[model samples]
Target: MFDKYLIDVATLRNTGPADAPTGFAFEAKLGYYRGLGLSMIEKLDVSIDGEQLPREAVRFDEGNGPLSLDEMETAYDRRWPFGTPATILIERPGGFPPGEHELSLLQQLRVSYLPFPSTNSDAKSVSFPG
Candidate 1:
């Protein structure tokens, strides 16, 4: 229901040094009104310019440090606070070539009281930092 706000399109950028970028990154917000532990996030599917990214190619970070998607499954110690954006990283050797690219994310978040996880989808055309 709150999928449109899942990604902060304005914060898209290449991560690591510009010349040797390790990947691209962008700020992401939770669809839920309140925050939950990283473990609550069940699935995160990302695609760039129409290509689906491998599960191993994406990472999540909340500023303190970066964690693999698998690691996040057990990251009970990590809290994604409400209204705060988390960084989503995609591993791409050169990142985007300074152009606008279609970025999309589909996430399944588990709400403890619900029988099924909440699914959120967001897509946008964002420019890489020049």
Candidate 2:
């Protein structure tokens, strides 16, 4: 989440082979807010099917390098904002089976006027039942 805003997942897709560099392309947005500054994300954690993906696997479409969960700051300019229609790419070496899975994202956010950072985490599972 970005401050009080929620980065929600609208769509999830597996566009690669199961054994290849496979992962989900999630289309997300900052709920209720128009947008957020680029540096607002202090740390981000991603997990698929309960397996935590490395920090190097997550990439924002507008950023040059991958995001680090331990990093204290962003490398891009603050002018670039993130909001709805943002596509986030998360890749793993060996992908999940062709079935239901749980996808979750925990984000530590930074606010300009706040004395301390905020925590915004969300989790949702994808289930297809017969």
Candidate 3:
């Protein structure tokens, strides 16, 4: 069955000042499931207002290691432990314009219990700092 599976946007920070960085911080509550040996997540897409950002600029941290979009495909050890929080960061230079914007994400996850990989995509509204 498909589900949100702990994928959620925990917090958002708007851009401020001239030299400040604007980005989105996300949290994934990965946990142990019956019969699942490990959870491997690779497909991660982050976009702002329909504009897709480069995966290379997205940062994914799973405590075991830090990986970017560039290494996502090659990184085989990207797994989260049970009941642990995984962090994902996407920073945009110049920051987002002050106002309401749509934040979207698509994640592809694999598990031993499932025959195929499961995908989760979600979007929500966010306001950047003025």
Find the candidate with the highest lDDT and give its number. Answer: 1
Clashes of 3: 1
Per-residue CA lDDT of model 1 for 1-130, tens digit only, reads: 6788888888888878967988888899888888989999888888988888899998998877999989999999998887788999999888755777888999888999989888888998876655
What's the TM-score of each model vs. the native?
A: 0.89, 0.67, 0.67
* Pairs with steric clashes in candidate 3: 14-129
Quick one: best TM-score, which candidate? 1
lDDT of 2 at 24: 62
The C-alpha local distance difference test score for the whole of candidate 1 amounts to 0.86
Regions more than 4 Å wrong, model 2? 1-10, 17-21, 31-34, 62-75, 78-83, 128-130
Off by over 4 Å in 1: none
List runs of model 3 lying over 4 Å from the truth: 1-10, 14-18, 22-24, 29-39, 70-78
**Candidates' lDDT values, in order?**
0.86, 0.57, 0.62
The Cα error of candidate 2 at residue 123, in Å, is: 1.0
Q: Write the per-residue lDDT of candidate 2 for residues 1-130, one digit (tens) a residue.
A: 2533333444666547644636666655443233455567766677877777888777665344444433325554532344645556777544434457676776666667779976666677666221
Q: Scored by Cα lDDT, where does model 3 land?
A: 0.62
